[model samples]
Target: MAYDEGLAQRLREALGDLPDVVEKRMFGGLACMWRGNMLVGVMGDDLIARVGPDGMADALKQPGARVFDFTGRPMKGWVVVAGEAVGEDADLADWIDRARDYVEPMPPK
Candidate 1:
């Protein structure tokens, strides 16, 4: 399935207040980048986040959250969450925030 453009738009709107936020096509969807670092993305009907290895185990505990497996193997520090999970709950912001936090600390070129 293709990524939902509407959902991507909503996500873009949500991140509108952030400066230097960029959206790029990736993984059959759209990836949100902050200061040249990838934070999260829209994949099909799911939201994929880069939570870093330290938070991977805890992030997997959330309902509707699962390891991201685009190819054959599941990635350790990435997660795929249902769109409804994010759309219905404000707590989803925590996940997005975690991803943004992780990426924001990286040195920009």
Candidate 2:
């Protein structure tokens, strides 16, 4: 599936001035990596976030967020934010920040 270009642009603008950030293609989408750790991306108009294990439950409680089950089994520590969840720039930035905070401490790959 083709990823959302507008969403990707929004993410790029939101991540402006963030050091060590890079854009790459993955999971049929465009991903933003911070310090070589996967932070966030957009898949077919839905926002994908690596919220970490501890934040999974709460992250899903947010509107338009659900398990990011690319395959049959759902992956832990990640969620897909869709619809109204990413409709606002502030909300999208918050989601991206959450992923960035979780991945920033991990050793780069």
Please tell me which predicted candidate would have the highest lDDT against the true structure: 2
Error of 1 at 88 (Å): 2.3
Write model 2 residue lDDT over 69-95, tens digit each, in one string: 999889899999994689898899889
| Cα RMSD, model 2 | 1.0
lDDT of 2 at 92: 93
lDDT (Cα, 0-100) at 58 in candidate 2:
90
TM-score of each: 0.91, 0.95
Segments in model 2 whose C-alpha atoms lie over 4 Å from true places: none
* Predictions in order: lDDT: 0.84, 0.90
10 residues in a row with least lDDT, candidate 2: 81-90
Question: For residue 21, what is the lDDT in candidate 1?
Answer: 88
